[model samples]
Target: MSLYETVREELLRRVRNGTYACDTLLPSVATLSEEFGVSPITVKRALRDLRAAGVLVTIRGKGAYVKKQVRILRQLDMRMHSLHGTDISLISVTREKISDPSMVSLAPPDQMMLCVRKVISSDGAPFLYDASYLSSNVEDEIVDEFGRNFIVDALRKREIRIVKTEIVVEAFPATGKAAEIFDVPNGFPMLRRNYKMVTTDANITIYGVVQAPFDRLACSIDFPTLAMEI
Candidate 1:
């Protein structure tokens, strides 16, 4: 490894493993350089790279420090990966006319939809609190299989193909119902995904929100690529 990379890697290791506490100040560049037997300029370059990696921060007058980040954010992908093994506890299921401004596009105003609230947990700890408003055109039997079947899979069983998906991811403090479900303090940082699904026939069939406290899980996405034979 190059000199700067070697320095940055060891510093990264310390920051991650808590040798340097998160949000606490790190050793001065000059001090670290002497300890590592490198010039202060090399150590400064390492610190600069770490800051860009979101692992460290440097206050104007205060020395470098570990950034206090308790969450991991990944890309928001529309594709289904696999069936969830998390225990699904049905919270409530009811038929209601859609009123949410964001959901109105998917859930027709005059037509009623199946509004379902459920919690997904792994090993007894809640990770996702999901609420979905699905077109009542979808059968009742499929709705009944919710806890056991993935929503996308159930839709496929009915020959409904998801042709388009629009998703928005936001990070904010949890409050009220969301905070209660995740069992975290009110105003705790959380990751929320709001998405709408449109079927191949051009019917908007699903409007949903998936929420989880940051400490519970990491997020990621894999997008498909298209290429012509070269």
Candidate 2:
């Protein structure tokens, strides 16, 4: 790696590892230059790249500080934008009977289903927790594959197609597992998105709940322009 790139990555590592907390000032360019054994110009270039990536902000005459987390979620596509520096980890995978009436569409209430939970983090801070219920088939294989990949991707590999999807958004307080994952107060506000995905068989095979700190996630919608009748 180039000198500036190396410097940038090390700085990012520090930020993610909490050496530099959110909204806290990072060491000055001279300090970083001396520590990294590079020139001030190299350090500046590194900091500039980090700032451009939305990871840090430079205040005139004040230096750069880690920015507060804000990940944009494109509601139409249901994907996060600008997630270049995030990590996904599987939390748990288990087989359980479908007790929720709404989930019976996936299978009979008495039948067992697969449950998978995962967490996504940025800057070493956990932001989103996702719990999904899926059809129970090849449960062992699903659990094994999920350790290194997402359940959705594993389902696709098995030729399971999501033909339709519906997402419902709401604000709820964090509690239980979500509260612990986010490390926030029990009553902290959260943005919850519940999704139901129907497969080719017209059965809802995937039902999931994704939650994040209310301020950490933003939703954007774009409308097409139309000519008005004169």
Q: Residue-wise lDDT of candidate 1 within 143-196, one digit each (tens)? A: 787646567777777777888888777777777888778655566777777778
The residue pairs found clashing in candidate 1 are: none
Candidate 2: what lDDT?
0.74
Among residues 3 or more apart in sequence or in different chains, the pairs in candidate 2 whose N, CA or C atoms overlap within 3 Å are: none
- Cα lDDT of model 1 overall? 0.74
Superposition TM-score, candidate 1 onto the true structure: 0.58
TM-score to true structure, per model: 0.58, 0.58
Estimate, for each residue in 91-142, the C-alpha lDDT of model 2 and write its tens digit.
Answer: 8887886564433444443567787788988778787788777667644666
Model 1 regions lying over 4 Å from their true place: 1-85, 98-111, 201-204, 222-230
Q: Model 1, 190: alpha-carbon shift in Å?
A: 1.0
